[model samples]
Target: MTFKKINENEQQNIHDRSCMILVNFNSKELAAIKTVSGFAGIRDRIAVTSKNGNTKIKDILDGNMVDDNEDVWSEKAIIFNNIPTNRVTGFLDGLKKMKIRRPLTAMVTEVSIDWKLNTLIYNLKEERKAIAKGQFVDHK
Candidate 1:
């Protein structure tokens, strides 16, 4: 098999085509994010509900059909899949510049991809709490 090695920039470009999933955001907040995303050049996005909590991140990332019609905790949050490593700061900055309330943000990871949306949100809340306390590094 003749394999064409991808360069660093090429690999990054492949990963840069990202998708943003919004959870528990109101209409105004959704509009704000969609506007920001437009400026940031992230073309793909979706808003999901708690019912979607059980959907695997991988399925979402793969563009599989999402059935959020099913009834489904977290506050306003955003889950970023396949976002480029370097663009995170700029994206956040875009939100800050627009004076939009910051939502909890997470990038897709190997372990996280298997998690349902609700599971990710709950864990994110816990992690945030841990970081806020002095006991974030519990040795136990």
Candidate 2:
């Protein structure tokens, strides 16, 4: 078996690395994500949400989501961790080129990494509602 070598900079726990967590994506959408990620040379950085949909964000960011059986969720979402802005832009552009439906997306933040998956998704939906009503405020 061939093992990949990681440098000193990558010696930190998995949370330090870039990751993209997909939640509730159908087979076609999951395939698209894999294709786009591979094209971006970040295929190893992709993950999927756990079947229970209650995994901690930090754990998800650490590539710890492991559900052997396929599960379903009402709304599809994507969460990104530690990815550079340019690469995120490129990934989104790639998705557009593939003609995939847009998924609710968010970047991991210091405050959000500790939240559970369901909690984060709830907040994101609320934020979207606020924005739709022109009541959204940027706290950052």
Q: For this target, which candidate reaches the highest lDDT against the unseen true structure? A: 1
TM-scores, each model vs. reference: 0.75, 0.74
lDDT of each: 0.67, 0.66
Q: What value of lDDT does candidate 1 attain over all alpha carbons? A: 0.67
Alpha carbon deviation, residue 1, candidate 1 (Å): 39
Write one digit per residue (lDDT tens) for candidate 2, span 1-140. Answer: 11121111122233576777788776877877999977766655454554645677887665576464343457778776766666666787788899887777777767677877777777777776676786754432
Candidate 2 error regions (>4 Å): 1-14, 63-73, 137-140
Give per-residue lDDT, candidate 2, residue 111. 66
Model 2 clash tally?
A: 0
Identify the candidate with maximal TM-score.
1
Candidate 1: misplaced stretches above 4 Å?
1-17, 63-74, 137-140
